[model samples]
Target: MSLASTSLEYIAYFSEIVLAIIIGLAVGAVVMWIGGYDPWQAYYQLFVPSLTTPYGIYMTLSFATPIILTGLTFAIGVRAGLFNIGAEGQMYMGALGAVLYGAVSLPFFAYLPMEFLTGILLAVLWGFIAGWLKAYKGVNEVVSTIMLNWIAYWIVETMRVYVIPNPIDASKTVSVPPSGRLPLLIPNTELSVGYIIAVLAAVLMYFILWKTVIGYEIRVVGYNPTAARYAGINVRKVALYSFILGGVTSGLAGVCEVAGRPPSYAITTGLSNLVNLGFDGLTVSLVGANHPLGIILSSILIGAMKAGSRNMQIFAHVPLEMVQTVQGIIIIALSVPGVVRLIIRRIRR
Candidate 1:
């Protein structure tokens, strides 16, 4: 496609996303009004504080950190024509890998890098199972990934409670060593350099997808596997690569959550800090139109909603569930245009 056409396509997609946001907010307002709450006040509490205040923005970005990576996991899969949802399981493995960082002492320079390497390696291995199965045995990725998620949850949970249990807390894994932990970007806040890492990862992904040869192959396979194969692209390799890449990002997210986030800096007994992060990324990926750069902006928006939801409940008397409902509505609205476009594409084909 020509550059101008590509630009136009992006603009159109952006416009559609904006419209979806408007429709979702309008619908949410109606729902709030019907429930006897002041919609305007609820929205004000939901957004203004988070967007306008420095502290709130930092919190929002901190929250956005992990999801940003996980969002990339999902987005990369979609680009490769795969519905790889193994990020949840992969993230679990990643966290466990980071937890291993506390098990042994190392030099300062090696400590942090080892933590990242181990976490990413474990997540990649976990993702490999599903990828190999799908590529070689034709196993359904969705089912395999779902089962793997549960397995990862239990495995990580057992390990956290047994092998890596914090000696003092007994409810969470051992904390990352000081050298391994990401430095805080803001004093006394969860904001850390992890946010910067996430942004850089997004930028890296954009470069890969738009400018690299392998990325072009992945996109080609996604656009049409048969055509890709006929054109001499290794379809199976691309599929496997996509899953491995997903694992890389998801694992990074897990590492960041445990090593970067404040307070515990460890996985809890129930994996509370890491739970639902992968699924939430699915929403982020969709809202961002499965684009890496777009995911950054979308993650912030989603993160803001999460940060503000508490304020909405406390100040506006809006139920937290209501905020969640609005998010669901937004996701549905955002998905509609993509679904329609997909249908149209299929019809044309």
Candidate 2:
């Protein structure tokens, strides 16, 4: 393509992204107003708290850990036109993998490799099953992945309650050994080495998806499987690869949680909180146009909203559900461009 064409394409892409962000904010504002609150105050509640104290910053980073990883997982699947909805299950498997490694005999240094590898492997295994089903059994990936998630939940519940029984005292939650914990790099902060790892993962994924032939093949397959086959690419293989890759990323998110945040195994009340991570990652990827860097920025924005929502509620007397409403509005407005266009037209009229 000519340089002018390339420049125009980049401009168009960036413009769409800006529009998406604006739409998300506008919809969120509207929702907040409908709730009988000032939208600006609602926005302040969502963003201001994390900026006020060190503890708040720490909390924000802690929340961001899994989100960054899950975003990547979601990005891979969506890029390939496959809905790998079993991220919740894959995350559980990854957590199990980390826990199992922590439960065994190992040195501190060994903990890092052992935990990460175990989580990655388990998640990949889970992802592979869905991929296999789709490839050979002609099963829909959506259905297969959803089923796998249920199976994963049972698997983890079994291990948590009976098999091995990793309970922290009689609390029924197992605390990881000192060695299994991530090394904190900052004083008085929850920030850990995992943040560095998360940053690296983002960079690596960018290269994998943009600079490699495999990425090209995956994109081609995703855009048109039949055409990919005609172009001599193995669509099945690429699809399977995308699913597995997505699983690995989700597994890594589990690792971040186990290593960086909780550093212990609980019954996963955070499951509801974390499961949507994969979904959030899906949104980030979509809003970002599946660009790796874009996904990271989007993840950070979401992390900020999550971190700030509590403060917003506490300080502004805004209901916490407003945050959820805002997120929903953003999803709807961005995902349905036609609606936005209509709204814009009406406003113009």
Candidate 3:
């Protein structure tokens, strides 16, 4: 394609994404009206808190950090033309691994690297297995990853409730040792150093996707495995590499939640908390056109909606279900091919 055509294509893709979000919001407003809720109240809750309160901003940042990582996970997989449905599982395993690290106390310098590395390694191993099953055994990653997520949930719960340092009253795991925790920068706030790490990850993702030879090969393979193979790219290796990258990104999300947000570990916490984020990552990936920087912004937008919803419920008397409906509308608009194509056509004209 000519440079001008390529540029036009990029514009069309981005326009589609923007249109999806707008359509999503419009659908959400309709859902609210049909549900007998005030659409103005719903919109206020969706947008107000992040603007009004410091705590809301802090929570928004906290929410943004992990979703950004998870979004990156899905984005990487999609870019490589692989459907990795196992990010939730990988995230759970990573959280479980981080909890294990939390069981022991180590000085700050030694603790940070060891704990982070452990989480990443565990997630990588899980991802590797999925990739191997897909590449060698011809199993579909979507199936394997979905099953893996269930296994992860059970394994983490079993370990937390029965295995390590479990006390009779231990519904929650013990607080992570102070040394194992992520350092806090914002005083008296939920915000932590994870935001910095998340930002770095986005920048790193951009560089890898646009600047690296390996990334180019991965994209080529995704575009067409036959063409990539003819060009001497190892399609299997690239797929496996994409799987590993996805796992690692999700792992980072797990570690950040355990180390920074909660300041400790809980049994099945990752699995439970990731209910929205796991799926939302797919939304973010779609909304952002699978671009790293775009994912970050999209994540922030969603995070703000989530964090602000509480205030809307408490102060504005809006139902929490309405918030969820809004999110669903957004996701559906992005996912449906016909809606997106129509939007793109309109924008192009």
Candidate 4:
């Protein structure tokens, strides 16, 4: 019975995903038509080669790495009964932590662990401030997190201008040291050990959230705070723990963006550098049904969009907003399970 129920759940999950994608595509097609673009050609150009070619695959994975970590951040927060909009701030702080530690000299092994931990710790503290405020002072997590994003953004931008501008390019920070960078998995590709790191983090989250006592407490608290309190679970502590854990993963995203991409070493150099990853994570988490494994697959799809959207205009003159429109429709379609269920019911009937 349990196995049958599980299989049924999996089927439903896959069904929602497929339906959401189709709806998203349908909406995207209408938008393309209105915008005077060929939807078929646009989508074909946008998706066909993303994973079919070597460079495309590498770029797709590279795009997936950070968002996967951020998706985990958001998904875990959902499980903990909190809406953590502060992953953006936590991500920035994490990158700052990497930069701060990279400035120092240490052994190869020591530098790697130390710098990565620094990112996690910094993000934890950033999250701790908001979590404590929410748990104790009655502050709203959404407002606090949004404010924190701007605060961290300007803080980093200010520091960029006055504190750590690169000697060669005053626009960006100094390069990360060789000891701190993640080695490439494939030669001459952007793919790095960050992919491995992200997968490991996902597995660990699944175990911690599903297979452990603490995870049980967190989920219980998320499901019903009042009940969990009556049951003697420390709701406040669990809230703090959830925020910190979310921050840790988001921070790791920032770290990977910094340390995983060598030679560049500077987050500022890239356009939209270290930005929107947290927002993208929210989309990814929702698309993945807030499951760790789901986030991995969702991130890949979104990543493919990211890598392939670049050529949309070149091949079909489809504006980049076309992709955003599809993603937004997908998120909206999935956000309300009622709609998905209704569609599924009609199909089954």
Candidate 5:
């Protein structure tokens, strides 16, 4: 494509996302008006406090950390022609691996690396199961991953309750040891080095996908597996690589959540702290056009909304469900273009 054409395409793509945001906000405003709330005031409270304050920015980045990694997982799968929803399960395995930190004693440097390695390996194993089933056994990845997710959930739950329960508080798993905990990036805030690491991971993914031979093969396979094979690219290997890379990133997400998040550095028996993050990442990935760089921006936006929801409730008296409805509307609107493209491709095939 010519430079002018490429520029035009970029403009159009961004314009679509902007339009979707407008539509979502307009619809949300109408909903708020009907609910007897001042729409303008509600929106102001929802955005300003979260975007304009230092503490809010810190919280937003902190919340953005894990979702960024999870979103990368989904984005990688999409780039490799897979609708991999296995990040949830892989993340569970990763969290379990990180939880081992509380079970063993080690030097600070060794402990941290061990936690990350263990988590990534376990997550890769979990992802490999689905990848193997799809690549070799011809099983549908969607079905396999869905089943795996529930299995992972139960396994983690069992471990939390029976094996790693905190002696001081049985409702949660044992806390990460001080030596294993990530240092706070900002004083008196949940923000930690995890956000920085997440951003670096995004940058690394960008390099891998846009500037590497393996990435070229993966993209080719995604574009057309038959064509990729005809071009001498091993389609099955690309599929496996995609899943394993996704596993690495999602595993990091789980490890970060357990080791970086404050006041709890531990998994609750209910898994409340880690629930739905992987699913949320799917939304983030779609909104970001399944690009690593875009995902970083999208994650921050979603994180801001999450951080600001409390302010909306406290200041505007908007109900939590109402705020959630607004967020859902926004995400669905943002996702429409991606969904339509997928449908078009499937129909053509």
Candidate 6:
């Protein structure tokens, strides 16, 4: 790419980030105004505390850890010309794999590595099913993945609540043994090594996608499958690799949540807390422009919003729904850059 073109692309990215934040905040302000709340104060609670306070920082990192992995999950799929909507289901299966390992009592080294690998393999197979169908049977990946998601959900849910039954707490999966759990970063806090893994995963993903031969082929296939096929690339192989790699990252995310967060190294019976992480990952990928570094930054923003939502409610009296609204506005802005461009065009004219 030419220097000028590269510079313009950077400018456009900057514009998207600025415009999305501005639009989300502006709409959120209006919503808060209608509800007789102070938008500025609410936003302060939403953004500032996550950075300034120790506990908030820990919680934000805790939340960001998994989403970073999941964000990369979708980001990788996007780069490989696949839309992996089944990250949620793959995550569940990954959790189940780890949970099964959790039931055993092994040394720390054996348990941690084995459990994580088991989770990754399970999720990879789960995602590969959809990819295989698309590659071989001409099935729509979206339809196949969506159906696989529900199949995974019921399978895991039934196993968690009924099949295993926790022997004590029927509503939650049995906790991971201490030796199998992730090591904590801070003493007596929820912070763990998951954040470090997340950062490394992002770095590795960025390197692989931009710096490797296989990655080059995958990107080429994504950019133009016909061209790639003409060049003798095995389109089916690339597609399966894309799906499986995405699943690997997502599976790592599942084990992170299960092993990193202390005092609750168990999956719950219902989808109350673990809901829509995959969709949130899709949102993060959109907001991040599907770049690894960008994904990490966007995941941080999302983690902050989630970590601080309760504080916003308690201190600023803003409803939790307002935070959701702000996120929606951001997603809308990112999804339809034309809206921002139209406003900019009118201003220029």
Best by TM-score: 5
Q: What is candidate 4's lDDT per residue for 60-130, written digit by digit as tens?
A: 99889999999898888778877787888899988887876545677777867877898999898999999
Candidate 4 pairs with clashing backbones:
none
What TM-score would candidate 1 get against the native? Answer: 0.94
For TM-score, candidate 1 versus 3, the one ahead is 1
Candidate 6, residue 304: Cα displacement in angstroms equals 0.7
1-349 per-residue lDDT for model 6 (tens digits): 6999967976797687777788878887887888788989988998899978998998888888888888888878777777778888888777877888756767777988887999999999998998899889988887988899889888888888766557877778888888888889998888899899988999999998989988898888877788899999999998898888888988988888888887878888674445678777777776777778888888888888888888888998876677677656656765555334334533543
* Tens-place lDDT digits, model 3, residues 219-317: 787677778888999888988998898888888887888788763344443346555566677777767777799888877777787787787688767
Rank list by lDDT: 5, 1, 4, 6, 3, 2
Every model's TM-score:
0.94, 0.86, 0.90, 0.90, 0.96, 0.92
lDDT for 102 (candidate 6): 56
Superposed model 2: Cα runs more than 4 Å off: 1-7, 51-58, 164-172, 263-273, 334-349
User: In model 3, what lDDT does residue 235 have?
Assistant: 83
Evaluation by lDDT, superior candidate among 2 and 3: 3
- Per-residue lDDT tens digits for candidate 1, residues 25-66, read 899889888888998998898889988999999989998999
C-alpha lDDT of residue 346 in model 1: 44
Q: Give model 3's clash tally.
A: 0
Could you tally the backbone clashes for each prediction? Answer: 0, 2, 0, 0, 0, 0
Report lDDT per candidate.
0.88, 0.73, 0.76, 0.81, 0.89, 0.81
Give the distance in Å from residue 222's predicted Cα in candidate 3 to where it truly belongs. 0.7
Which runs in model 3 stand beyond 4 Å of their true positions?
1-4, 51-53, 165-169, 263-270, 337-349
lDDT of 2 by residue, 1-349 (tens): 5999967966776687678779788877777787888888777767766656676666677666676777787677766767677777888888878777645787667886888898899999999999989988889988998789889888877776665464545433365567777878666576777777777788888899879998888777666677788999987888889888888888988877766665343335434434566666666565555667776766666777778888778777787677677767766655554234334533543
